[model samples]
Structure formats: C-alpha cells, structure tokens
Target chain A: MEKKNTQQEIEEEIKSKGKDNIIKKIFSWILKNVKFLLIPASRLEELSIRQIEYEKKISKRKFIRRMKSTLTIFGMLLIFFIVTIAVFAPWFSPYTFDVLVGIAPGNYDPPSPAHLLGQGRLGRDILGRIIYGARASLTIALPSILFSLIFGVIFGVIAGFYGGWADSIIMRIMDILLAFPGLILAMVFIAMWGQHMEYIMLAYGIIGVPYYSRLIRSSVVQSRDLPYVQAAKVTGAGNWRIMFKHILPNCIQPVIISFTFDIGGIILSLAGLAFLGFSDPQLIEWGNDIADARLHLYEAPWGAFWPGFMILLAVLGFMLLGDGLRDALDPRLRNIYGAKKKKRKKGKKEENDSYEKK
Target chain B: MTLIEEKTEDSDRDPEVILSVRNLRTYYPVLGGLFRRKIAEVKAVDGVTFNLYNKETLGLVGESGCGKTTIGNTILNLVSAKSGEIYYKGVRIDNNFTNDLRKKIQMVFQDPDASLNPRWKIVNIIGEPLRILERMKKTREIRKRVLELLETVSMKMEHLDRYPHEFSGGQKQRIIIARALACNPEIIILDEPTSALDVSVQAQILNLLKDLQRKFNLSLLFITHDLSVVQHVADRIAVMYLGKFVETGTIEEVFYNPTHPYTRALLSARPTFDPTTKTSRVILEGDVPSPINPPSGCPFHPRCPKYLEQGKSMACSEDVPKKIHLGGEHYIWCNQTK
Candidate 1:
C-alpha cells in the first residue's frame, strides 16, 4: 500500500510538471523506474550464469572442430615460432645485424661455428639479421593490412549500401586504382612520399585497398537486399546503423579470410620492393639481406638461401592459416564436416548394436 | 468510464478504418547501354488501392510477380511508390513517415531463414525495434519486455541467447513475430510469413496470428500466394493479378461468389482432397505476361478465359476495365462480367 501510494504520487507529480518541463519529467520517470535502472542482485547472477553457458556452447561449435585440423595446427605453430623469434630477437641474436665481424675479403665467409647461418656480403651474421628482420616485416605488414581493411570496409559499405551514383563513383575509382599494377602503384606512391619505412608501408597499404574494397563491395551488394536488412529498415533503424551493425557483420567473413592471405602477400611485396633497391640500405630487413646476398650467390649460395628460405617459410605459414580459416569460417563447409562426423558416429553405433545381437 | 463506453459504442456502430492506400504504383527501371539509360520499366505495382479496418486481417493474395509484396513494401516505405498516397489513420504517410508512425507499423518478411540476422541472438534481434523506436536504453527493461513478447509468441526463455541458425524454421518465425510485436505495433504487414514452413507448422502459425490479433487488436496486411492459408486467417481478401487488384471483398463474398474470371481461376486452382467431387479446374492458359510490356487495355486480357471465350473482342483488348460493384463492399474490375 505504501509503495502504491508513492508510485501514484510520483506519477501525479510527473503529470503536473511534465507538461512544462520535459527534462524534469524524464528525471521523475527515471526516479519512478529506479529499480529497473539498477539491476537487482538476483538478475545479475542469472545473467552471469547464462553468459557462462553461452560461452561453453560457443567453444564446442563447428569453427572449433575445423580449427583442430592438422594443417591448421601446423600453421598456428609456425606463426607462433616466428612471433617468438621476433619478440626475443635482441636476446636471441648473437651479433648485431649491422656489425661486420670478418676482415676485408674474408667478410663473405661460409657457414662457420661463429656465424651459424654463414655471412652476407657485408659479413653480417645471417641468423641474427633474419631474427631482427621478422620484427621489421611484421611491423610494416600488420598495420598496413589493418589500415587497408578499415578504409576498404568503409568505402565498400557506402558504395554497396547506397548503390546508385555513389556506387558507380566509388567502384570506378577502385577500378582505376586496380588498373595500375600493384607493384607499379606502390612504386609510384613510394616515389611521391620518399623511400622511408612509413612511406613504404603507406604505399603497400594503399595498393591493397582496391582488392579489399572490391571484395567487400561484392559481398555487401549481395547482402544489402537480403530480407533481414529490409526488416531492420522497417524497424526504424537508420542507414548508418543498418550498414555497420546489421549488414557488416554478415558480409565480413570474406573480408576476414582475405585479410590473412594479404598479410603474407604484403610481406613478399615489401621484400620485392627492397630487392628492387627501393628500400633503405641501413635497414636490417630480410629483403635487404637478400639484396646484399644476390652478388655473392655464386660463391656462397647459403647467404641468399637463408633469407629467401625465411621469406618462403613466413609466406607459406600465412597461406596455410588463411586456407584453414576459409574452410572453418564457411558455414556450409562446417556443416558438411559436422554431418560426416555424425554419420560416422551413427554407423559405429549401428555396428555395435549388430555385434551385440550376434 | 463514460469515455470508454462512448468509444465502444462508436466502434460498434462503424468499424474504424486504420490504413488507406490510394492508387499506389511502384516501378523498377531496367538500365542498359553504355551510359546505363533507363531502357524500360517493370510495373511491379500499378495503381493498387485498399482500406484496412482496425482489428481485421486483410489478406492480399496473388501469383508471383503480381505486386502483392510490392504493395506491402510501398506501405512500409522500403520501396518508393512511383505515384500514390498512403494514409495511416487519415494522415498521409507515403513519403513522410514520422518515428511515431514507424513505431505503429512493422513487417514480418517471408523466408524465416532470410528474415533474421544469422549473426544476432534472439534477445538482440527481438529487442532491436524497442531500442531504435522506443529509445529503451536500459538493458533490464528491454530484456523484460522482450521476455514478455517471447511469451506472447509462445517461445521459451532458453531460446533468448541462441542465434537464429540454432532454431528450426517454425521457431525462427515465432522469434520474428516476437520482434514485430516488440513495439506493440498497431499494424503488421506479413509478406508470405509461412510459405517456407511445413503445413502443420503453418496451421500453428496461423492460429498464433489469429490469437495475437484478438489480443492486441492488430490490423494485418497478410500477403501470400497460398489461397488456403488466406482462407483460414483473413477477414477480407484482395485478389491481385498482374499489377492491379482484380477483386476486393469480404472473405465470404469473395470466396463464395468470385465474380472476376481471374479470381475464379485462382480459387479453382486450390487443390482438394475429396476424390468423389468432380470440380472443373480453371487452368490459366500460357503464363503471367511480363510486367515490362504488359498487354494493352486489361492487363489480364492476354490469358483471361472470359476474353478468350468472348472471341478476343477489340473492347477487351483496347479499354482498361472499370470497377463493377456487386452489392455491399464487394467489387471487381471486369468489363465482360459487368
């Protein structure tokens, strides 16, 4: 009875004051529903329990099953190995990449006890340079790919969602960017911005935007007219909200699969740029080491071989991871695998039942 | 108490018309050539008009590409009408729908799989309308309201945090219904809501729709290609052929005395289980003509059985048919029958 009287009083107060002041009315309504504003302890416990159950269910989903493939595990291990080497480069490397240990003509020494992976033309320890090179390669590639993804998704969603003059204009611009060979475009960007590491990364990043944008654009276009998007519109969601919140999540799987592949591709391209003498000579990059070893390839093949091998390993690891991710992320493929597993289990159960009857 | 009595008396005397559509037309342009010029226009919806009374289910039935879905979309403003006026409770809302108007009107789309965002949980999907239209910011309030809606649709609490893919087709439709009911919408446009479900599930959904209608006094614009489903739920029926409505009447009037030849052919197309009764099926010859270059005069004249029976007269080929009133609230557009 007391609670009812207080509620009625608050309601009456709001009715009298709300006619003149909207803010005061809102405040009074909030006060009236204060219990709802601060959730009760019982509700909090229930929500936490629900969340834990949800997480447990999610972990056992098809994606997890697909991730358990042998090749995917190998790819993950390979990436972990490279990342560990990169992180511990300073502690692990026996000599600085820039230091020349051997004297004069003997600087181009073969593989020895002192320098495990032989020496470059400049007599720098190949293993030490390769370890440090992992850091430089990742720093450039990861951030650049992320940059491309952000801008590409923005442009693609806008072009595909609005889809009229905006679609034509943005897509044509992307087409123009794609018309230029990727290397040539990167070179042009590097030319304009100078040969600094940041400029090189920016060039690589910009060169990649067209591919990501086109990929996201096609997916966005296909999903934009889907009934769910229309339902969101009918529910009074704005164009921006519909694009980012509803449509983007559905169309982003292809973009995610493409992202992993592009990391390796960008790393290779950076090495190519270095090989073409666009990179700084002072930098202890894999591509720079390979470039330095090119002259001594005939006498000591190990110099060029080590750096080339590291690039190959890095690229192969990323490619394998990308392939695995593509298979895992595709719901159709995941379901197919799941069905096969179920069928096998059913077959085994039937065989066991028959054996017991026999 | 007197105000409530007076409102009931008013309603008893005359049924209130909640939504009125006047001469609605929606066209899609086909672009071609180097410069992407508008080559031709597909008349998806050409001049459709109808009124939906409060607390009544108005079923809009048609064959594929006959503008049934287009009409629903035009009312929702998802598709811009080429020329039309849509008045919601006497105020025109075709191109000018306020947030309040939007809150009162919602849609349940066809294809349970396609209608839901596969990525979203049932709670978020059902709570979306409340968050957007009502500005209900508190999570607890929204969840409580969502729970109420789920119960209204007969869905369980365990389905809340699960994704759409986790549910069967029927359950997904129920969740969609819960989403549509989140804001307590006065009118719901159901575009073939059960064409994708099994027959048993279809019957269950129809019963749920009927129950929800009585509970909330909702005006439903149920669009479907299936006539039996329409017969089970609709209070009134509008039969569409090509891009125009061929007939509109109460369910008994339309079902019992289908005046228009197109409506008769459509009614006769419904399959019957009784083998003893020999019913002459009105098989529509040829196919629905392309809406891009629809025949002159009556759009249905090309394949209309009456037109063929009357020797393909020039009158049927040259003049557009006018509406003929066959007594109270029942009318059809057919020159030959009149």
Candidate 2:
C-alpha cells in the first residue's frame, strides 16, 4: 500500500502539469535545433527538423555542389521552356508544318531577308520546320524517357528483392533484351510495326530497362539485409510496404545518378531512330531536319549545320548537367568533402594537444 | 483516477492470461545444388510454448540462433508459425487476428537503422496506424496524439517532420516508441531495443522503456540474450535453448533457484563486476549443434551435465521432458525439475 502511494504521487505530479507546458516544451526544442542548424554543426544529427534541410545542408560535394546550382537552373529552364513551348505549340509557333511560307529547292535562296535558315531540299524554310518540330520532338523524348525509367526501376527492385529463381529468371530476361543492341532492337521493333511515337518510346524505354532495373535491383538486394528492413517487418509492416518504403529510399542513389545520364542517351536514341528513316514527316524533329539535309550537304552546309548545332547543344548540355548531378548528389565521391574532414580533424587534434599540455 | 485511467487499469490489473502458446515450431528450409534440391530444415524455432498475462513483462533469453527473435517474430505473425496455436487475448493468432490485432499489439525493433521508413517523416510513421486502424477522420487529432507520443518518449514536437536517419540510435528508438504508442497498444514486443546502442545509452533507453510501460499500463515481451539486462527489468524470465524454453519463473525465482542445467549454465556465463572472483566458466563442450540436424530427444540432452543419472534411465533421446508448474507460477521443462 505504501509503495503504491509513492507511485501514484509521482504519477499525479506529472499528470497535473498542463498541456500548455508540454506544447511549450516541444516548441523550445524546435527553436534550439533550428539555432544549431544556423551555426552549421556535425555531419549527422541526433534528430532533424526535415529531410530536405538534412539532405540539402548535409549533402555537399565541392565541384558537384558548386556546379549543381547553376546546372539545375539551366536544366530546369531548358526543360521548363521546352514543356511550355510544347504545351502552347500552336500559339508559340510563327507557322505550322502545313503553312507554305517561303522558298523553292531549286531557287537556292541564300541568308536572304525573307528566309532565315535559307531553304531545304523540299522547298520548305529551315527555321519554320525547326520551330514547328519542337512539339513532336518533345513527344518522343519526354514520354520515352519517363516510361523507360519507371519500368527499369520497378524491374530492378523486384529482381533484386526476390533472389533465387525469380532473380535468375528476371536477370536472364534482361540479358536477352541486352543481347540485341538498342539501335538493332529498335530497328527490328520499328520495322515490324510502322514508325510512330509509341513504338519509338517503347523501343527507347525497353533499352533503359536493364540499366535501371539492374542498378536499382543491386541496391535493393544489398539493402534487403539491413537492420531497418528487418525492423519494419518485425513492426508488422507488410512485405510490399517494407519494399517500397524502407528499402526504396536507401536505394535511390543509383536511380538519381542514372536518371540524368540516361535522359541524354534517350534523346540520342530517338535522333538515331529518326536518322534511319523511322520518323514521321509531321514530327518536326531535328533528326528529320538532318535527314532531309543529307542530299544538300554540298550546296548549303548551314542546312546541316543549324540542326546539328542544336542537337550538339541539347545532348552536351544534359550530359554536363548529368555529370554535375552525379558528383553533387554523392558526398563521398567529392574531393572537397575530404579536405573539409581533414581540416576538422586537424582542429580537433590541436585542441586536444593544448589541453594535454596544460 | 479518472474514468478512462481507472477503467483501463481496472481491466488490465486482472490476472487474465491473454496468450497461451503451445508447441510452436518454425523451421526454415535450406536448398542446395544447381537444381536447388531440398537439403534440410534449419530448426530455427523448435517446439516452444509460454503463457502471457495482460499486463506483464516477459523477458526471453537465449544465444543468437536459439530462436528468441524467431519466437517474437512468429508471435507477431511476421514469420509463419509452422505448427502451434498462439492464442492472443483468448483468440487464436490467425490471418484475421494478425491483421486486426496490430491495433492492440505492436513491436519495437532492435536496429533503429532499419525499423523506420527513411522516406517517411516521423509524423507519417507514427500516424500510420491511426490512419489504417479504421475509418477515422481526425487528422489533426491524430497529429496531436503523435506529438503527445513523441513527448511521452521525451522527444520534441519538431521531430515529427524529420526522417529516421536524422537521429542517433537512442533517438531513433524513441521515435520507434512514439510510433508503437500511437495505436494505444496493450502489448509491445521489444526485440532487443537496447542491444544496438552503446552501454551508456542502453541504461537511458531501458529506463525510458520501463517508464513508458508504467505510465501506459503496457505489457511487454522483451527479447534479449543478455541475462543481466533481463534481470533488471523483466517480471518473468524465460530461458530458451535450441529453440525451446527450458526454465521460466519470476526473476527472483529463476535467479535464486534455477532448475534446468542450461539455465544454471547461462547464469554462470554472465560477466560479474568483481574481477577477482572466478565464477566457474560454463565452457559447454562443442559449438551449438546444427539446427538442421538437432540431436534426437531433448534438444538440450547433448549439452545437459546431469542427463546421465538425475534424468530418466531410459534413453535421453527418447523422452523430451514436458513443462511442470511448481507453486507460485514457476515452471520448468527439464526432467531434472522433478
């Protein structure tokens, strides 16, 4: 009875403390942590305010970090502009593909006042075709890229997570898909079925499957044995929840790296497919421009040069951005982070030595 | 006491046995060769059984692979219980109870590193049960409750927005506790919650767990191989060997008067603070017998010191001893218990 009395006394003391006090305590903790953030503390936190701030402040690769901000701005602008132009294609364009504005092929029009990129073999203005083609090119590039990435990630996760027969079967399927090169398989696929965006998208997307699926699968397989995944299972989370939630997040490093790099590759593949006479006329694509300019290579070099320059800029821009992302997103790979660690260690050693001397 | 407090405590205080597991078995099948031929079953959890009261802490102790973790997993229906009936609150653990029972019973994993979803914010992790439990449409109330749970675990309200990797092991465990407490669960299975932390942090976490149990009137199934840790917090201690519980009783009962030889041997293995005192080391002959082909009869027979004379003259392999209850809820499964 006496023992019970003391327990109740202590319990009552805690209970009587108003709810306002509890909330106040919570608010004070938040304020203190935010202050800790301003000073720029350790690599990891005992706890954090949010993952974004944690990932942002904590994740820094010197060259990658330096380049990422600029690259992101450029990449986003390019993408955002492309998407905007594509969406408002009718309004944005000076003329559509059907509009017959300027020049005949035999006229051999120079950089004249009326026609900007001169005239192409088919007696169509070069500038008009390029502008009109933006919408069609985006249709092939955007959907193919997205669809491929999604398929690869899913396939990789499933293959990696479930090993043994499932793994062997899925891996073999990937191997077969990889057996035929992207261009060859795309040619084979497009030949049987006529050239359309869906076939081109499906072809490009299928090629990216093995890359992402393997990358994601390996990460998932490695992370499957981690303590956190086991904990989730023990905590009553179903298998699917654990796979998509606990395991997927840890394995995102590979996906992010592959995403940027593959965007450029997908664009190149679409261009290659178009170069091989697989694209539609109304598509208004750069590849189609280059293709049409093949016969006029000797007469007007600018006919080939203009379309080729745009292709080079687009592919090269994405490639540089991909390199920036790969470096910035991974802290361990950055040389700048090593210097920072060394500096911190030296300072800590100096402090310890001075204290010991005293 | 207030109405809800008085009501919950009143019901929990009654010594109503909630679960009575009988002869539980879980053996993982091992396959070998290029063709993946069946080899043998790793008897991770051989026959094991125990009774659990509504409001009590049952500490399960055993070496790694001895099936303490497997038992907890099996009880929670994480792994299939191959052959056994696990009654939960007088209802058998099955597909329905396994699903619906999650609201009443929860688990805290050993590794803080992996238990939580790294992508999910703490608020989402804690409030998941609240959303899934029923057609409850009180998001704000649930958030408030999650905040309260964080406070209960001595974490700040701001932690609600953070991910799992942001915290240290101790802090992560606290977040896990907050999540477990969200459903207002009656029982929480703690799978070595302190084993993954440093020695200094272990005490703080253990104290927090004890405090939480008292405050919430919760029953806990604490699985750990550390006998001393179990001794400190457990009301009842069950000693397992080769996937079977050989001895069980109140902490005082088991420590003061151990019946099974394995239990006595386990107690001797615990490192004492006094370096000078040589508590005879229990160097068990040979490594633990492979679970794939465990010795016939009592799984403990190959290692039991008193199996020759004290036990039955009949083949020690032939007869596996059954559990016999002594007075005051003390139970032992050894033939030597007689």
Query: Which candidate comes out best when scored by lDDT?
Result: 1
Per-prediction DockQ, in order?
0.45, 0.23
Q: Pick out the ten consecutive residues of candidate 1 chain B with the lowest summed lDDT.
A: B1-10
C-alpha RMSD values across all candidates: 10.5, 9.3
Candidate 1 vs. true structure, TM-score? 0.82
| Least accurate 10 contiguous residues by lDDT in model 2 chain A | A53-62
Candidate 2, A1-358: lDDT as tens digits: 1455677887786777744477788888888678676767542454443333335434441344545566655865666665666677667555565763343554435566566777665566666666665666667666777786788777777888878888899889988888768887778877889765687778877887887788889889888977667655544567787777778766877677667666656665666777777766556776767776777788887677776765665555565566566555433343433457554545554553454344
- Residue B143, candidate 1: how far off, in angstroms? 3.6
Place model 1 in a CAPRI quality band. acceptable
Q: How does candidate 2 fare on TM-score?
A: 0.77
Off by over 4 Å in 1: A1-58, A61-77, A97-106, A185-193, A320-341, A344-358, B1-15, B138-140, B310-315
- Native-referenced Cα lDDT, model 1: 0.82
Candidate 2 DockQ vs. native: 0.23
Model 1 lDDT tens row, B75-119:
999889998778888778998987788789989999899889877
- What lDDT tens digits, residue by residue, belong to model 2 across residues B218-280? 889999988888998899999988877788899999988887788888888888899999887
